[model samples]
Target: LGVRNLIQGLGEALPFADDTFDRVTMGYALRHVADLHALFAEYRRVLKPGGEVLLLEITRPERALPRALLKFYMKGVVPAVTRLFRHSSEAQELMRYYWDTIEQCVPPSTILAAMAEAGLHQAQRRIVLGIFSEYCGAEAGTDR
Candidate 1:
């Protein structure tokens, strides 16, 4: 499939009115933002009292070998992929910094704490692909 429904958006701010949406979905979109906490705050603000947000994310694996392999793959192979698509070294560098898809910058616990601080009632982190994560969260006031 080709890319479709491409959107221009600010990572830290969304355009929707508060408490309007039932759910917000993100695929590997939170970590690269300059302030993830603020983004979560916005998610909380826009969602209804019982609404939820589902996020697809990559996380550093707990095991040693898998973690090492993921880091190596991200650092070594990702740049090549960026070149294949972007065809520019500067773009590649930007991609490497913001879109490299590695999970090393922040730890798992920090993510959980952020959800809690963002007023999310129940937040869960599940790792898939042995190197990525799926996070689902709910608003604090009501069950959804």
Candidate 2:
């Protein structure tokens, strides 16, 4: 991981020049964003035409059983285990918050639509293990 040139910036207002990158990616942060439209617009603006965007997120399961199990694990078992291990209250709260965000995150369809509305093409989502979502979209054209 000898990466360099890491610049910290907001997702909705990326601090980059137009068409500067070939791809943009976000991992497990979609639920925390203030606005999907603005975030995707920023991604589109920073990407070179034909560039791609990828978002990796943990979505709540659609099935009731799996959803309930996940909720129990995240909200109950995780916090209980952390407390058993003598972790701080902040850590326990953080686990609950993580579950809350996933429970309240926008649907995959809405995310794809936002990508399309931001001018990206071929917007789609791939679900893994019934919970992990990989969202992908591409810039409209190869030529500016």
Clashing pairs in 2: none
The local lDDT score (0 to 100) that residue 123 gets in candidate 2 is 95
Across 1-144, the per-residue lDDT of candidate 1 in tens digits comes to: 998877666746887778988898888766676777888888888899889988887776778998777667666687788899889999668656743446544677787788778887688888778867778889965433
Q: Can you write out model 2's per-residue Cα lDDT over 4-122, one digit (the tens) per residue?
A: 88889999998999999999999999988879999998899999978999999999998899999999999999999988896689989988998999999898988999999998899
TM-score for candidate 2, residues paired by index? 0.92
TM-score of each: 0.73, 0.92
| lDDT score at residue 63, model 1, on the 0-100 scale | 87
lDDT of each: 0.76, 0.92
lDDT of 2 at 134: 98
Q: Candidate 2, which ten residues in sequence have the lowest lDDT sum?
A: 135-144
Model 2 accuracy (lDDT, Cα): 0.92
